[model samples]
Target: MWSGPRNLSTAMMYAFAARGDCAVWDEPFYAAYLKATGIDHPMRQEIMTAHDADPDRVAAACRGPAPDGQAIFYQKHMTLHMIDGFDRGFMRDCTNVFLIRHPARVVASYAQKREGPTLADIGFVQQAELFDQVADWLGRAPAVIDSHDIRTNPRDALESLCHTLQLPFTERMLSWPAGPKPFDGIWASHWYNAVHASTGFGAPEGPLPELAADYRRLVDQAMPYYERILRESGRNPNSPA
Candidate 1:
C-alpha cells in the first residue's frame, strides 16, 4: 500500500499481514533506497537509526516467491520514497493500494508522534507534494481508499479493495486476530495507537482534537481533486469523501 507518514499505514499493514498465510514486507526496501538516493529527509536519522534494509537483500525480498497462488502478500510503502536511483517499477508492478488521510490529521498525529518534526512543521506540504507526484505517475486510475473510510466501514471498503486487486472476497479478510504481526514497520507502536492493535473495523479515527477544524478545511480542498480523479477513473467509492 502507498501511504504517507502518520496515517494508519502501519495498522493497515498489520490488518493485511494479520492473515495467517500472508507474507508481509514492512517498508521492506525503504531504508536502503533512502540511503541510496540521498535525500535530506527529516526522518533520515531515525531511518538510519532504525532497520537497515540492505538494497541487494531488498531486491531479493521484493522478489519473494512468485505469488504461490495462496496468501495475499503485503508490502508497506510510501509514495514519498520514490527518489532518484530507486527502481520505480517496484510499486507500479504491484497491485497498488493507496492509503491517505486529511493533511490536518496527519499534522496532528506527527506532533503526537514526537518524531523530529510535526506535519505542520514540514510534512504537510512535503508529503502532499510527494502524494501529487505519485498520483501523476500512477495516472488518475490508481486505486485509493481513504484511511477514514476504511476505519469506518472496513468490510465494505476492503471488499472493494479486494475487487480492485482481483482477489477473492473472504470473510476472514474482514477481521483477523489482533496484535503485532510479522514485518510491522518499526513505526508500528508509536503511531498505530490502540486502533491499530485491534482487528475489527473502527469508527473512522485520525482527526485529532487540535486539528479537527483544519482537517475539514483541507478535506474540502482535496475533495474536488479527489472527485475529478475518481470520475476520470470511473471508480467511485460507495461513500465518496
Candidate 2:
C-alpha cells in the first residue's frame, strides 16, 4: 500500500500484520528516501544506519521471495519514497493499493511533529503521479481506500480492498496487540507512538488542527491532486472489486 505521512498507514500495516498469512513491511523505502535526498528527518541517522540505503537493493528485496514463505507480503510504502531514478518495475508483481487522507488533515497532523512541510513532504503530488502511472500500466485504476472511510467503517472498506487484491478479509485485521512488532521500522519510536498504543482504529477525531499559513499553502497546493485521486479511487467502502 502507498500512503503519505500521518495517514492511517501504520494502522493499516498493523491490520494486515494481524492476518496470519501476511508478512508486513513498514516503509521499506524510507532509508532510501533519506539517503537519496539527504533530508534531515527525525532519526535520520538511525534509520539510514538500520536499513539499506540503496533504492535498487531495496527494490530487489521487495521483489524477492516473501519472507519466511508467507502467503502475502504486504509492503507498506510511502509514495514520496519513490524518488527520481527509483525502479518501479517491482510494482508490477504486486497489487498496489493507494491509501489517502484529506491534505488538510495530513498537513495539520504532519506540522505538529515537523515544521514547514511542503507539498512534497506530505506526498500528495507524488501519490497522484504514481497512481496515474500505475493506472496506465494496469489499464485501470488500482484499489484506493481513503482514511476517513477506514476510520468510520473499517470492515467494509478493508473487505473491498481485499476483494481487489483477491485476498480474504479476516476478522483478525480489525484488531491487534497494542505494541511494536519485529517488522516495524527502526524509526517507529519517533513516528508510531499513537499506533503502538492502539489495539484497533481509534475513536473518530474531533475538529482538525487550524492550519498555519505555511500548512494552509501546502493544503492549497495539494488539494488538486488529492481531489483527483479521490475521484478516481473506489469511493464506496462496500463495493466489490
Candidate 3:
C-alpha cells in the first residue's frame, strides 16, 4: 500500500497482517530514505542502525519472494519516503494501490505527532505522481481507495479493494490483536501508539478538525492531489459518500 503518514495506514497494515497468507513489510524504504537524505526524525540513529539502509538491497528484497514462503506480501509504504533520485522501477513488479485521506485530516492528525509539516512531508504530491506513474505503466489507472471510505465502511471498502487486486476477502481483515505486530518497524514507538492500542479501525471520523491558518494553507495546497486520486477511486470528493 502506498500512503502518507497518519492516514489509517498502520490499521490497514494490521488488517492485512492478520490474514494468514500474507507476510507484511512495514516501510521498507524508510531507513534508506533517511540515510540518503540525512533528515532529522525521531529515533534516527536507531532506525538506521536497525533497518537496512541500502535502497538497492531493499528494492531487491521487495522484488523477492514473500518472506517465510507466504502466499501474499503486503508492504506498508510511505509515499513521501520515495524521494527524488530513488528508482521506483520496483513498483512495476507489484500491484500498486494508493491509499489517501483528506489533506485536512492528514495535516491535523500528523501535526499532533510531528509539528509544522511542509506539503512534501505529508506526501500528497508524491502520491499523485506515483499513482500516475503506475497508471502509465499499466495502461490504466491503478486502484485508489480513500482512507475515509475504509474507516467509514471497512468491509465494503476492503472487499472492493481485494476484488480489484484479485485477492480473496476474508473476515480476518476486520480486526487484530491490540498492540504492535512483530513486523512493525522500530520507529513504531514514536508513531504507532494509538494504532497499537486499538483492535480495529476507529469509529468513523468526526467533522474534519479545525487547523491553524498556516496548516490550513498547507491543506489547501494538498487538496488538489487528494481530490485527483479520489476521483480515480470513483468517488466525488464533494459527495457525502
Best by lDDT: 3
Predicted structure 2: clash tally:
0
Candidates sorted on TM-score, descending: 3, 2, 1
Clashing pairs in 3: none
Candidate 1 Cα deviation (angstroms), residue 234: 5.5
Query: Where is model 2 more than 4 Å wrong at Cα?
Result: 234-241
Instruction: Please give the distance, in angstroms, between residue 188's alpha carbon in candidate 2 and its true position after superposition.
Output: 0.7
Model 1 agreement with the true structure over 1-241: per-residue lDDT tens digits: 7666766777676666555567777776557756866755546667766866576666555655535553667787665554445655545446666666655566556656553352333233434444455668867556777777777888888888878888766666567567755456565565556655677666766434454565556545544544444344455633433
Each model's total of backbone clashes: 0, 0, 0
**Between candidates 1 and 2, the lDDT winner:** 2
> Cα RMSD (Å) per model?
4.8, 2.9, 1.0
TM-score per model over all chains: 0.70, 0.94, 0.97
Model 3 lDDT-worst window of ten: 232-241
Residue 104, candidate 2: how far off, in angstroms?
1.1
lDDT per residue as tens, model 3, 2-30: 99998899999999999899999999999
Model 2 Cα lDDT, one tens digit per residue, 1-241: 9999998999999999899998888898999999889999999999999999989988988995889899999899999999989999899888888998888889877877888888889998999999999999989888888888788788988898898788989999999999888999999888888899999987656565677786788788998888888777645423221
